[model samples]
Target: MIQLITLDMAGTTVTDHHEVEACFAMAAQKSGLTVSDDRILAMQGLHKYFVFQTLWEEILGTTTHPEWQMRVDNSYRVFTEVLENHYLTHDITPTEGCLELFEYLHIHQIKIALTTGFYRKVCNIILEKLGWLEGLDDTHVGTASTTIQASITSDEVEKGRPHPFMIQKAMNLLHISDPQQVINVGDTPSDIQSGFAANCRLSVALSNGTHAADLLTPHNPSLLLGSLHELIPVLEDLRTRS
Candidate 1:
């Protein structure tokens, strides 16, 4: 009885390949802050600006610092440029069997929405590159799998993952109520937390994306999957259970 499935953009539906963390790391360094890859990866599924804000605060050891906003802004601006250029110049691919999963959901009359921690501009760039924007309507773009019902981004919401704003926004736009009829799938702890906050019937994680199974495990999703391909059977099973 699932009405909608909200999937994350990077690291969940799209391939990460460590590019995101690389960009963040470079941006941090450019802003005069040194950060580890693990720390950057741990911040996945959060709003980009908030990520810099938190990192800057921690690096400087004080939120009360007068230059906090300036530093955060500088780091975030650099990160956005780096990330967008990386996606635009580099090859980006969707996760294995991602398109097939979209087709299955489409055939079942289950709407799919992409909810991302990324801002709208870069999201469009990635979608366009993958041809996911083909035949796009006002709400969403179409891919080989199916036409998405909506594409919600972090900037579109008051807050990002772990706050459930993006998922909630997608549900509202797609006219989906009853969180029990929703499935939120992601590759990070924040993604799992966000789904649960929305009370989704299925809050699942994919280890093949961003965080490893070990990192996502403690978040306690309904299940942990390896890739989007694995979710097809689970969805079919859920249909049967319904």
Candidate 2:
């Protein structure tokens, strides 16, 4: 049975509109590095620091730039400021059909978990702005609908996407022990890899958020949908079978 659904923030459940990439590129530019839009988009769903490290590595052509750590730290510090202000200043909203999906899962007694590449501060800003910050636990925030069982952020986990730590942590917080009972959906390759690594029953991908359908296809997701509105049928079918 699918007891829980773990969804990603930003480009997954939330409408991103490339604001994240813009912020990252802005920070990179400020830090004396030229980061391409494709490169920034490719790093979506990774921990912000790692994103900075990787970009810096590419710019310097080695992981061992003499001041690599310093540069990474400086760039990340700037990125965080830019990202936080961007979110706080902008009017953030859930992606199309995101709330409907949450409601459907709620009615079916399926738990909703929100996991994000963002650290707690930025993630909370987005959540609070969307009015989804009610019923928060010490470690995480809950949705306004009370359907969200857990919220996991990169800051709360030892690692981010492409690793199963955040998903596993959400499962743990939600009191869900079986990875087979979980479905993970996101809009990035890292999202797919993380779900697969978590051993989830369904590693679903959404194409409407960040990457294109073609960009996400090679990850071999168990299911891929262009929009969140199409999620119900896929989930209902799984419910019937399981």
TM-score of each: 0.95, 0.95
Tens-digit lDDT track for model 2 on 1-242?
A: 99989999988889989999899889988998787788788889999898888878887889877988899999999999999999988888889889889889988889888899999899889878886777877767454357477889987778898999999998888788999999999999999999999999999999998999999999899899987879998888888887
Candidate 2: how large is its RMSD?
Answer: 1.6
lDDT of each: 0.88, 0.88
Best by TM-score: 2
What shift in Å separates residue 170 of candidate 2 from its native position after superposition?
A: 0.6
Model 1 Cα shift for residue 122 (angstroms)? 0.6
Once fitted onto the true fold, the runs of candidate 2 whose alpha carbons sit more than 4 angstroms away are 141-145
Candidate 1 overall lDDT versus native = 0.88
Clashes of 1: 0
Q: Against the correct fold, how does model 2 do in TM-score?
A: 0.95
In model 2, what are the clashing residue pairs, if there are any? Answer: none
Superposed by TM-score, candidate 1 places the C-alpha of residue 135 at a distance from the truth, in angstroms, of 3.7
